[model samples]
Each structure stands twice: as C-alpha cells, then as structure tokens.
Target: MKSSHILLLLSLASTGAAAFELGAPKNNNTDNLVWTGHLSPDTDSVTSALIAAHIYGGTAVVPEGINPESQFVLDYCQIAAPKPLNDFSQKAVGLVDFNQKTQLHPTIDESSIVAIVDHHAIGGAPVNMTQVTPIDIRAWGSAATILADRAESLDIDLPAHLACTTLAGILSDTVVFQSSTTTEYDRYYAKELAKEAGIVDLKAFGQKMLEAKSDLSHISAAEILTMDYKNFSYGGKKVGIGVAETLTAQQLLDRRNEFVAAMISYKETQKLDHLFFAVIDTKNKRANLLWIDDIDAAIAAKAFTGQPKQGWLVLDGVTSRKRQIGPAIQGAIEGKK
Candidate 1:
C-alpha cells in the first residue's frame, strides 16, 4: 500500500469503465447460439470454444487475427480458426476465456450471451444465470479445465485431436503446471486429458506445445502487441496488459523498440489509461515487464519487486499474467487508492 500508488490510482479513478450489467434485452439470435472468446484469444480461448461448439452446435467465432502458436495448434488439430464474427444474427451467444461485455465482439448483444465458460475474474454476468441452461465460470487455472471436465462428466466423446488441443490449452494457461493459479484439479484433469488425447510423453508433448506457442517469427510489431492481450476494469481505470510467451526473453528484447512503439500506438488507439507488455522466457522461467512511461515502470518495479533497467522491469521468476502480473498491478492500484 504505497502512498504513491494510492495517489496514482485515485487520480485516475474517476475515469472508470462502464458499470457492470447482467442482462441484455432479448435479441434476434435466441434460437441460434454463437460462441466466442475474448479478443486476441490464445490456446485456452480457441480450444475451449472448439469443444463448446462441438458439444453444443454453435459456431466458434475466431478473433480478428490468429497468433503463430494458435495457428500452429489449429493446424495440428486439423481445424481452422472459424471466420471472424461479422454477422451477429445468431440468437444465443456463449463466451469463453472472458465474461465481460467489453471483451466480446462489438455487435454481439449482451442478451444473446446465454452461456459462458471462463477462468478470469467475473466481470458482469453477460446473461442471467437462471435463464442460461449451463453456465461455467470459475477461477481455475484455465477454461480448458472446465470444458474438458464437462465433456467427461457428460460422457461426451471428443475427437482425438480435440482432446490434444484441449490438453494444450491447459498446459499453456498453467505454464505446464508452473503457474501459481494451477490447482490439483488442473493436474488431475491434465493427466486424464493427456491419456485421453493419446500423448505418450507428457514432458515431450508439453515442451513441443510450449515451443509452438512461443514462436513469433514473421509477425509485425503491431500484431505482436495484441497477441494474447486483455483489458481489465481496475477500479474504473481501463488497464490493458499483453504477454509474449517466447522461448527466451532475449527474443523480444532484440526488438524492444519495435515492441515499445507498437504498445504505445496500441494504448493510444485503444484509449487505455495504462498498458503493460510482459515478455516471458518460458525456457528460463523469468520475465521482463516493458512499459512506455515512468509510472508504469515504477508500478512494475514495485509489483514484481524487480530491478528496473532502462524502461523494462526485470523479474526473476514471473510468468503467469493471471496469477502474477494482474493481481500485483491491481493490488498496487487498490492498495494505493
């Protein structure tokens, strides 16, 4: 609860995000359910939606652009990222990876969000819980965990590739069981999923999957900026954070200027008050927090208690944004306020 952090948070508190609303007026797509994940969906988002679509018969809406690892996963599974969500004529909607209205597609009616499967903090409930036949939202390691569990409980037979992809989602979100948010249920389900998916060596396949997720070659700086990015309503302030899960932190540092410029442009374009881009070294289990302004660097320094070098905050053992970066930043903001 540093005074500077409090003052900083309070100064920007008035510019809060829209109030949380639960129900949207009923919409046209009540009979045809369309499912989607948050913007810039990663493995968990993509896989969870795939499973949901398979079981429930909804079209899985892909985000605007797909990342390399996500592309790799989709290709490996012999599937394609569903076409972008342009037409919203479907009757019902299901959200994955996130629950906030702001995180959904622009044209998607909140009333149409009849179901959801998410692992993040509950934003507003997009749909009335009582009205939705099945709503799965929990603070687990990954949304993949919830959906995979559901498939098993219901005795729904998932295709082999789908199982593998679901397992990939679990490994990615949990950082192969290294993240703090991981629970026993995550481990239990992961083991079951790995077996179901016909993965012989967990270590080998997990490493291969992680490697694929870390590949960012041939992608532009601007595209990289939004890769696995998410925005949060922190006490009314719009806080945006992005992550690059590369094999090594050095891979991003090599293009620091490009990354920084992209982030700055993205922040201004998105009208975000605060933005942070974390470069994760999955190989070494370390990270570097990059930001444009001094306040952001200072916040990262305090949040991770890491050393600030130039404009980047070097963290010794930081990886999971959900478990580490998100809470630390939120705490710094709230504690100071």
Candidate 2:
C-alpha cells in the first residue's frame, strides 16, 4: 500500500469505519483495476462505473444486466455498455452506487475491493479495505454525481458521451430533482453536464429517459420484482424492497395479482423476513405499494400511515425509494421495539 493510502485508511479507521480485514492485499497497478456497481444496477450505478473508469485508469464492468433507463442513456449517448463480470478472483475492484455485502456477488473477493464511491449507508462493507486502499462514500444523491464532481475538480475532461450519461444518471437517481435526495451539487452538476452534452432542454431529455424506464411491456412479473430491487437489514430482520418506476402506474397496477404471487415466491427464495414492492408513477410522483400477505400489509400500513385500497397502499408524492420508502420502513420496524 502507498503511504497516502495508509494514511487514508488510518483516518477512516479512526472514525470507526474499519472492520475485519478480508485478507486481500492491495494491488497498485491501476491498469489492472476494474470498476463495477451493485446487482440489479440502475442508471446511476451503470453510468458511474463508466465515468469512474474513464477518469481513473481501468475497465468498466457490470454485475448484471443494465436497466432500461441505463440502456437508453448509453444508446442515446452513443456509449457502449460495459461487459459483465462474474468472477472477481484477482481483480482490483472499485464499487459505485452501493456499498453492502448483501448487494455484492457471492463470488467477490472482498479483499480485492480497492475503492468504493457510493451514496448509500455503508452496511456490512468490508471496511478493512480502507486499511490498504482509499474509498469514497458520502451522502450525495447519486454515485455518478460524486464521480462527476471529482472529474470536474481535477480538471479531467468528460467527453460528450460520458457527460450525457452522467447527466442521465443524475436525473434517474434524483427523479429529475423531484426526489428528496436531490442536493444543490446534484442540481448544479446536472446543468453543467447538460451543457457539456449539448442537451439544450434538460427536462425533455429526462422525460425521454423516464419513458424508456417505464417500458416494461415484455418483462415478466418476476423480472419486474428484481429489476430495481435491494436488500436491507432493518430491525434485526432481513427485508427486501423493490421499486418499479413507470409513467403509467395503472398499467402495472392492473397486474397486481401476478406481482403479489411473484413477490411471495421471491421472498421465500431469498429467505427474507419481509418484502415490499412500490410501483412508482413518475408523472404523478406517487407509488402503489403492493403487499403479498397480511404481514406485509400490516408493515406497509405502519410505515406509510395509509390504508390499503383494493390491496394496494396509495402513497401520494412518494417517488424516491431511498429518500422516502426505505427510511420510513426502517423507522417503522425500529419503532416497533
């Protein structure tokens, strides 16, 4: 490890961020480094990996298939999608968007993680990676925003494709700045990136991306449930939260029975104690929360303070799962004790 990396590790460790070492040594060869994001990656995760690899010297890879919005951004910007990476045996890895053990692939060598630029809480992260490497985890709305800001500060040139995708990432994660997670930095960078990408009408471009994200016409119920899902540990219980953003919420709500059945099967297969799915209407900025059974309905009622209507909880002005739903659910679970 470099002396600077050692100093950074020591500083992070003093803040109680260090955990047990996963026994992987630090690799200094930047050429061999690879950047990736969480499973079921959304637009921000996908774009952040590309941007990170561009600014840093490495290849960008995806843990799984890119979501629709991400694909739309890549195609629109004329950027090719990164290849998928299944094995992390000898690779020096950097993570974007998420920092959790549960979100990682089972085959990941925890010790090989040299960097993490994420906008989420550090849950079960192998913090000991800090002892041998540098990591960037902050409260920004999107990991893409973090990387974009870094590139800007360091005077790193962001090409047109990267700038466009970075802007798309910010829009997707912040829901066009409607999400509560949106910060001033996110807003500022979005505008700057828009100009750099030659997007004269930012809102129009964001609408296009959202429409692309809403096009789930040919996907199955099980695929929808896993599309933008995440695993969280709340109140000593394993919980799974899935969000499906669409322009036409009614179209998806019509398939409530199918989604419910799929949710139940997914819950059982993952052995999760609780599972919740929120179908978000981006236009109206609301969500139709679906429950699989009585237990899930009870939990939703407590978390959202809303009664179920025809087996769905109507959450008005609830778009951001990270900002609104997940925190509410976690609070409700903790409050029960």
Candidate 3:
C-alpha cells in the first residue's frame, strides 16, 4: 500500500477512537522504520505527543500528574486532530487514578502509539516496542521543543491549537527557558515554532504561565518539593536536590523557613546523606542555597567562601543547574576527593 493511503487509513481509524491496546504500533511500518529514543514520559512529553497526535491524527493516552494519592482520573485517551474528538470533552484532564502508581513502560501496543519524544535519562530499552516511532529524546528543557523541531523539520503545518499547546509546554518545562536545563536548542526551536504558529510576544505568554504556577496560596511546601525533586549518588551516598524559582529573592525567602523545614523533614524520611534546597531569583540571576546536611554548609563555604549564614549561602554568579549549580556541585564534590 502507498504511504499516502496508509495515512488516510490512520485518519479514518482516528474517528472511531477506541481505547489504546497495549503493544501495537498504530501506523503500519511497511518501511520498517525504527524510531527510538530515551523515554522518561513526563507531562511535557505526554502533552507534546498529544498535540502532535492531534495534528497528525492519532491517539494519546496520558496519565495523571505527579500526585499519586489523590482520587482522580488524569488519564485520557483521545484523538488529536480534525476539530478534536467528539467523545472527549474540552475540559483539561485532571490527574486520573491518582492512587495508581505511575510507571513509564517502554512498549505500548501497536494500536496505540505513532511517535515518542521525551527529555529524561534513558531507562532500559524494551523489546518489541511498537508504539513509539521517530523517538526523539534529549536531556534538555522540554520535549515540546523537540516535537516542535520535528514538526518543522518535516514541514508539517502546525494547527493553532497544537501550536498553543506546544508553546505552553515549552514555557512550563523550561520555566520560561530560565531553568538550568534550558538550552540554546530549546530557545531557537521555540522561537521558530512560535513564529510558525503565529504566536507573538512569547515572553509575555511565558510570564503569564509562570505567574499561574507561582501562586502559592493553595500550594504547600511539600508540593513544591516534589515538582522538581531529583536525587543523585556521590561518594557512596545519596544526595537529593529540590529547586524552586521565583521572581524575587524575598518572595522565595518568604517560604524560606518552611522550605528548610520541609527539606529537613524529607531528609529524615528519605534517609538521604544530604539534601539541598535552592531558591533561584530569576530576575536577579542569584541563588540562595538551603542546606540540610553538615557537608552542604562546608561545601558552600569552600565553594563560595564566608560563613554558613543562617543555613543559607548566597551565590551571586549562580543561576542555573547546567551553567552554575551543576558545575559548582561538581567542583565541590571533586574537591572533597
């Protein structure tokens, strides 16, 4: 069968919109293309796929958000394009089955997946992974940027809805591209994607998204910790770091006491060798590091000089993980050796 005919059949299948069966590749691979990449399968990646599927006519099965205790069905299976699937409502899907543990399985049945894109450390590769085609995973700012790049490279015209979704994904994942993980590739691709989608004033849009997430009135300190929590092993010990960014140091400082207390509590509970909570003042390009272990203060003192100062260490030149924090931590760790 011709490739065009296959695509036409896929579009027609989208109209029926059945539940995604596991282990099936939705698109026929007469060409036997092996699209592969690392799949962490976070929100940005899932949402990016959803938008792309909408544009290309496919199903998107997205699980709930990070919260696992809440009783909600964040999972939604829907068709991506041609005026949205009628069976699925337009409301933003909430965390589905919050009680269910979320796991990233390497293979979804052939009937479910058309492509995969992600940005996290690669997990063990799977056998007979039929769903993900043209997988593109880079440990960078956002998978949305990767998807946008793919769409552009293929010369695939992006619909306005998909474009807006992609834009939002980039803003959220990159923290408006101010995150340490943000890369030049992310910025360049986002700019081009925004232009292609006819989105102007991306800066303002990013600000709006940041403001929306920054509202702390309803969020607790613990909630903030889990949003960007990561752990690493060093010197036969485990260290965990949580990062939060705010418009002003004072704004982050307002939560300083609570955040510090939370770090201590998390450290004891998780039994980590060390815990570091960093509040980044994006506007000033400064960072305030809150330490939960003895080495942290010493590490900061040697790395930055001066007294520990209220369990807080000020870093003037420190701004991002890739640019500043990662290097500082590496230096401190290496210095210990």
Highest-lDDT candidate = 2
| Worst-scoring 10-residue span by lDDT in model 2 | 1-10
Pairing residues by index, what is the TM-score of model 2? 0.89
Please provide, for model 1 over 51-143, each residue's C-alpha lDDT reduced to its tens digit, 9 standing for 90 to 100. Answer: 877766667777566667777777766776766776565546777788765566677765555566777765423333323333456667898
TM-score of 1: 0.84
Per-model C-alpha RMSD: 8.6, 5.3, 10.3
Runs of candidate 3 with Cα error greater than 4 angstroms are: 1-46, 49-141, 173-184, 196-198, 302-310, 334-337
Stretches of candidate 2 off by over 4 Å are 1-28, 123-130
Candidate 3 C-alpha error for residue 129, in Å:
12
TM-score of each: 0.84, 0.89, 0.62
lDDT of 3 at 131: 29
Query: On residues 44-86, what C-alpha lDDT tens digit does candidate 2 reach at each position?
Result: 9899999988877689999899887888899999999999988
Error of 1 at 240 (Å): 0.9
lDDT of 3 at 241: 65
